[model samples]
Target: MQDRPTPGQHWPITTWQGWQHFATTPPPTAPQPGEPPRSTEERLAYHSAFVTVRTPAINTLATQVRTLMLLGRHQQTTARPSLIVTGPAAAGKTTALLEVGRTCHLAHTRKHPAPPGLAHQQVPVAYLLVPPGATAKTLATQFARYLGIPTTTRMTQTQITQAVCHTYTTAGVRLVLIDEIHRLNPRTTTGAEAAGLLKDLTERIKATFVYTGIDVAATPLFTGAAPNSPAAPASSPAAPSPPATARPDPSPTSSPTWRTPSTSPTTHPTHSPATPPTSTNAPPAASEASPASSAKQPSPPSATAPNASPRKHSKPSSSTTSPKKQAAPAPANRPKRHDADVKKSADTPNDEDFAALYDRAWDILIFARAGYLDDVSAHYDEVLHEIAQRTEHTGSLGKTDIAALVVWKRLTAQTRWATDLMSLPDTHVRAVTEQAVTAVRDTTLPRSEAARTGRGIIAELPGLRTGDALASAVLTAAAPQRMAVYDRRVQHALDTLGLTLTPAPGRYGRYLQLLDDLLSHGAARADGWSARDIDTALYQMGANPHPAGT
Candidate 1:
């Protein structure tokens, strides 16, 4: 055999077996260099990310998303934590929420984007926006979908709650987001009542919820908790023992503020034979008993208490029970006039009452945009002038007549005025009507409807689209003429600011979707953003009609 090679040397093969080994043996290889780890963007690209927003906030929102994703990982075996991004109009709450859904690896998220701009996230990390003209059922349908609950054609609140709990529990969701909460209130009683039902469903569900609204007051049900509160300190300082005094008088404004008694205290009889000696002393005048006392009166032992010991209490019999038991206390009556309701009612619009106001303002915007504020007939200007004077004196279009007058003046003005009136409270709408007419004395009229509609197009603005009913009134007043509704100003503002490149639309739904997508894109770039930022930016975009330097 050939001399054997050394231990460290390559072996010499001469035999058939050695040749076989040599033929099959692997080569001595050089070390391979390691490739760099993939980044979030790379991984996301591999997954085919397609968000389209380009705002700077997106990067921040992306960071939040990573944190949330990490948090979600820990939550995979438990309830997921809820994330709510609330802010005023145009704040990117909805968009940021969508970014979470798009970038996060949570099971899946239900996205419900609403019209006229309201976006929210809900249980199981589902994102939803309360419909523009939301009613209780409209909201319920969305809730049911997010929770994975089913509802019948005519499901009741009880049914909705059961479905919500069952679905949320089954889906392993821990959070729910409600957006554009302020639009919940409606002009009609039916609308208001429906809103109340939605409010109740939210309270009943156990999922952690985040709600977005224009103002803090608009969402009293949610953020009502003390800021940075702990878990109720194990137990709240025992609800202070109510002091003895007359029952609190019913409040006149307690229409929708009914406090449902989840577990009513057992009602005591008017008087008790087994009454403790402590309470048996001369009955204090009803006026003297604190309101708490009246609400908690014990029944006479002989009539209502079957558990009373025979020695200490007389037995109650069927005969002792009156044909009609005294009426149980009605639940705390609903708040007749919560500030929201008061504001809504006071702001409600009516027909011809505000007709003239609309007419005059319409005329003004038309004239101003068309560059013809000096050719209108003197009488037309005078009518607007008079209506403006009346609105200023009244301070608000609370009455139908006043709204009609305002509408009339608005329609006849030389420049477009509808967009300006949208954000103002009724009081401001009235005052502004006064100022607009005073500002333009001899505005020219558009020669024809076609010319007028084409000459002045108001950019869609947030908070401007009244419901179908209100829109109908204004559109009708302008007559067979088609004027683009000022319903998506925020979107237009974003586009104008170069924050977004998407073209704004006249319809409310389109604009809402666009904004949601943009915000989501922005949010995906980083941590979540404050609603104030979104709102402030949009407001600033619109505050200057000429786009801030034009």
Candidate 2:
């Protein structure tokens, strides 16, 4: 009898009941790849019609809000900075807001877990669309609706506000999502009263307020703030969305990705020399150049993988090469399926300035990803992030734990692999995923070998056999600091930058290797950068190959 949330309800979140349903009901059995057509017509129709496309903007927005949640959790006072999401209708403003709310929902559940038997009717997130002809009392009633608090026609706005605020506080609501904000005209007496009520609720309930409306920045929403209140950040940039997209604000520190930096050819695969050699004088940093089996070479070590060789090798043959540059040599021990990865590292720039070859394309990516570098990079760094730190990755693993990780991977990648994920029995899936994640979490394993060990195990699942994209995301979610994400876009960006990443079987490990080389050049956390940040940068570069800046 329980209802599940549709993808529509939460491109931006879930209803309280929707969230409860997921908490209570176990997932249904997913069909195997080779299984015959035993599912009903309704199921087939549902599968075909329910499509979930990944949206980078939503990921960015979700990451931003999650970061904000971390900020609020540590605060000593109740007042938190409110966010306003305004853009043209159909631009996914509501979707972004809801997604953030859902993120908070999951994060809260993860933090405070309770089984169905012990679970209470606690509300951590509330989503409300500004009602048509909204007024102070009407808006207050909307708040009451979510909590199922009865409001009679005789109830005064003050009484409603007191009841709503007290209930939300008791329910432990942390996120208050308000959409269709443009419908409220602050200039009107009623609109002003509604606005005041909103301010009062935000102050009294101890929750972060997020407002979404159409073209609200230029509307009265911006100017209507009481002179004494902290006005919504003058221009709270709208998060990105695929449909009716909203533009993200530009990053101030974002510079030309095309600026070619010099790198040493002979440095270790794990890291390049602080000041790279002018040329490839020494042997190409034995990046997959010398297969571990092909020669008596010791496995190289990266910061993350102290015992294993880095997987990716970027030997710039020519910084002058126009669009579409070469990738670094592949690891020597890669599967025999491909040979390009094993090629010797070229005697060229270890580092090619992003601008030198793909300035325009990379510049555009920088414009997008750079704006959220701090938030997105820190996406997994705290309470709201994806991966737990090395210390907290302990305890027994279960199907739900694995399912949670799979969900995290889907959210971060924004892909619709739910069907693929459902292929294996939940228990079997958990067993395989646990092994893979455990490999990466091993503090003693060389970072490179840990990645290889982990990637190998996860690849056993149905959808992961062919590509490293999803597998890499899973691994990164396992150890956010030690691993970077890889996908076609990251690959394309690398190749376009003239960096190398062959399509060989061991590409996942090599990709991390490449990231280490890049990170090494900048020095370990010198600029507070990590494998994830570099991965995001490269993803940006590959995502938009032909940017306007070019």
Deviating ranges (above 4 Å) for candidate 1? 1-84, 102-123, 186-204, 213-550
**lDDT of each candidate versus the true structure:** 0.32, 0.49
Q: Give lDDT tens digits, candidate 1, residues 1-550.
A: 2222345655322221232233233333322479567778766554452233423333444444344334444432222222223344444444444443434323332233323444223223444566775544556666675433656654554566567666665655444545665454322222333444443433344444444445423232222221101101111101101112222235655321111111111222222222111110011122344422222222222221111111111221111101111111121222222222222322443433233332332232222211111111112222222332333454322224334533432322232444454434755544433332232221253112222232122112211232221232222223211122221333334334333323223232232233333233342221222221232223223322221111
Give me the candidate number with maximum lDDT. Answer: 2
* Residue 377 displacement (Å), model 1: 57
Q: What does candidate 2's lDDT look like per residue over 1-550, in tens digits?
A: 1234455553212345654543344334446799787758857654443222224334545555555555556543334445556555554455456556766777788878767666555677888878885756778888887776778765666688899989898988887888887776543323444655575666567676666777665554454231111122211111111112122224545421111121112212223113211100001123432211111112222232211111222331211111223232222221221223222222223525421333333343334333222122111222213233322354223344445544443333234555666655777776777787778879798666688788888877755676775567567767765877676667666666556678777778776665554444443222334566566556544543332111
Model 1 worst lDDT window (10 residues): 231-240
Cα displacement (angstroms), candidate 1, residue 336, comes to 24
What total of clashing residue pairs does each candidate reach? 111, 29
Clashes of 1: 111
